[model samples]
Target: MKVLRRWTAALSALSLLVVALPASAAPATRWEPCPVAGSAERQECATLTVPLDHRDPHGRKIDLRISRIPAKGTSRGALVIIPGGPGNSGLNRPSTVNFPAEIRESFDLIGFDPRGVGQSSPVSCGMAAADARRLTPWPGPDGDISENIATAKRMSEACARNGGDVLRHISTRNEARDIDEIRKALGRSKISYWGLSYGTYVGATYATLFPQRTDRVVLDSSDDPDPRRVARGWLANYAVGFEDRFPDFARWAADPANPLRLADSPDAVRPLFLDLAAKLDRAPQDWPGAVPPKLNGNALRETLLRGLSTDAGFPLLARTMAAARDGSPAPVPVLPPDAVLQNISAVAAATICQDVTWPRDIDRIARDVQRNRARYPLTAGMPANAGICSSWPHQPAERPVEVTSHGPANVLLVQNRRDVATPLSGAWKLREAFGRRAVMVTVDAGGHGSYLATGNACGDTTVTKYLLGGARPAHDLHC
Candidate 1:
């Protein structure tokens, strides 16, 4: 969701005009087994050499790392999983997230690290850890953004000084081109895709660029497709998302049966959280081992936001909220391994900065911060402010591609009603953009990922039916 804006710019440009890259079947450059432990049998790795600049197909090349998990039985087609971060590498998907056996047996699962991410030709803005930490300020007290502007400037300077030529090429349009090249390299006339979060943007770009080449495409947690307000729009949506999803957390926290309960009832939970956050904002508490050094209002909010990504994360939110209410600062939860965080952050930044040109006008952001802070106190002003993209040097190489009914009617969009990240409102907008070309399933559940992560039987069954039997709902359906 945070990364959606960058791709939105690329998609917008694409929608305004069409830039064609000739399609050609190319041979794989280098093929090897993935080195990640426990992935040897299920995953194989390869390098795909594509032109650094698509306009000059015969020019210098950049390599994309590709991974595949072969189908157990006969294959229906190859299902490519596009990782969300413009910077996210899909190279390890074969070993991480579990795939339904039926789908796995029918399709070869493919994943790739988009250029400048993961095992592909990696790029770094070379930001110091300290400077990078400050780049995105936690939403300020009352959602003010005076601090965010300063952070944006510092981050931009670090990138301008350290990010090399590769950073300039990290736009979403280029990534779409990279996907087409991957398709050609794989010898597939059409490709199936399951894109999550920012991956939805990539999938949309591919569909726009090569509609004939798209097979079964599922965009989970869909985003606002408007090019002009890509990431910016997403940031604002946190206000509604938090409002919609927080009730779930509140319900769990206030339940008497739950050991993690923090309030007498769900109605009491919201105020409790708001009060604690305000208390923390006035007096920062020490929590050793937490990132950013101490437990503060913004950190608590960040945790709450991250926790809303999945249902399993609800407990953490409850526990954290409970501890905070008791006045005993809890340690920041351990994150994934450092290497994983490094890779994730790298991919996220590259994709975001490359996709769009953030507003250079600090005043506009400041105003937005003020407005957002007033309306969405929970997220503060952090969601509305500029990120590394504000300081990004280059304009998007290509505009965002508009998704329309021009493509084949092969897309299935599944969304949770209360997703804190992507949010339901954005998903509705995506469905509208697709027009009659898509059928959406709105699940009566919460959290980010919907089809699998949301525990709604109807929602999962509907998606599974489509994926396995190519059956789509008659119209936009609700479960």
Candidate 2:
């Protein structure tokens, strides 16, 4: 009776939108072998055909590449694993993720490449490798964003010239729509989900748009779903995120016993890093084969941000920092293939820009940068500065979807307390938006991802229990 009531209510809400459906009931997704070496041999692949524009569902169609690993025994249901990066590939996730035996046996693990990413009707900005590497929009020396503004304008024009029609439709809302299509194609009435980073936003949007269809949901490393800001807020969060997480790195780097120690104490690490950055700003060191072939202040800052994602990267970061301080040749920057970088850059720009319009007022952006730089010296003003979205070619076709507490109380948000990408502050906002519909488990850990990644027994067990038995705590938990 409860299920029927929820379903009816969801149908009534969906009726407000032009629900895209095929002319005739579409057949169940046919799977074919697409195995990943050294992993699951039974991993199957398939393609989903969805509309280019949800409003014009019948107008044009695009393909989404999907992959799945079937449940071991009698399946409980399907669990879609949505990866991070408005730009990361998801097709190999089912085989790659180290799921517990129970989870592997209980659910058919599924993953998909969102439109304009990976093998799903890929789009490109035709960006040079160097431009793609510098997508984060680092401010010039003296906190000037003139170069950042020019880069934004140039990148925006490049995308407009090369990104085609699909670029315009690549957005969080549409990704939610596509996930619904995936659900329909699977012939499931409801689907379980595990979403990481930006995927958490997509999952939140889906749960909002189609509440009844959501079963067990675990959102890891959540983003702030502020309708007015969205991606802009996520970028700006790096300032707070860096501040929250850098202390962990500093503590690790300052240990006397550690071979890569940069400072004698944690208190000294911050000044040392700032001094190195200032020195680099005045004189960048040349590397033989890096993108720009120079280790500048911005590049060092970028490296620190990446290094803060996980504690495991601390050694390499310490080595790099030590070399920079010692006036030695910097390590070569590791980068993905040029083609992959272009795809990521295009999709990231399209998604961020199309999801919502960024503030275009140069004066306001510059002022924000100055203020942000003053408050958070570690991340500089990069987080608050303008990017390609500032000069986006088209305004969003619709306003950003607001995640609310109207959905069924089925969400379990598990987050690390100090994440360098998605900090606890933003996670709290997402949790507040979900209200009665969600219960967040705050892990007393540092880094980007929580759950199995963090090895927090309480956090992992809580999520696994929800996934398997549909159980949740009466209130928010501090694991």
By TM-score, the best candidate is 2
Give the candidate number with the greatest lDDT: 2
Candidate 2: pairs in clash? none
Compared with the true structure, model 2 gives a TM-score of: 0.94
Error of 2 at 3 (Å): 34
Local distance difference test, each candidate: 0.74, 0.87
Evaluate residue 190 in candidate 1 and report its C-alpha lDDT on the 0 to 100 scale.
Answer: 76
Which stretches of model 1 miss by more than 4 angstroms?
1-31, 35-41, 134-137, 142-144, 336-343
Quality of model 1 by C-alpha lDDT = 0.74
State the lDDT of candidate 2 residue by residue for 1-479, as single tens digits: 00011222343455423234321122445577888889844888878778899998767788888888888866777899987898999999999889999998888888999999988999999976677877797898878998888888888898989999999899999999998877776656778999999999999999999999999999999999999999999999999999999999999999998988899899999999999998899999886688888888988898898889999878778877988899887777578999999999999889989898889999999999999899999988989998888888889988999999997999999999999999999999999999999999999999989978989999999999999999998999999
Per-residue lDDT value at 76 in model 1:
72
Candidate 1, residues 1-479, lDDT tens digits: the string is 01111222333344323223211212332345665676444576777677778877767677777877777887777788888754566888866766777887887778888877866778666555654544345656765665666666666665667666666677667888898776665556678888888888788778888889888889888888778777667766878899889998888877889887788888998888888889889887887777667677877887898888777888877777766777676847876554555445555665666565567787787787888777877877777786766766567776666778797889899898999988899989888888877999999898888866767889888887887778799988999
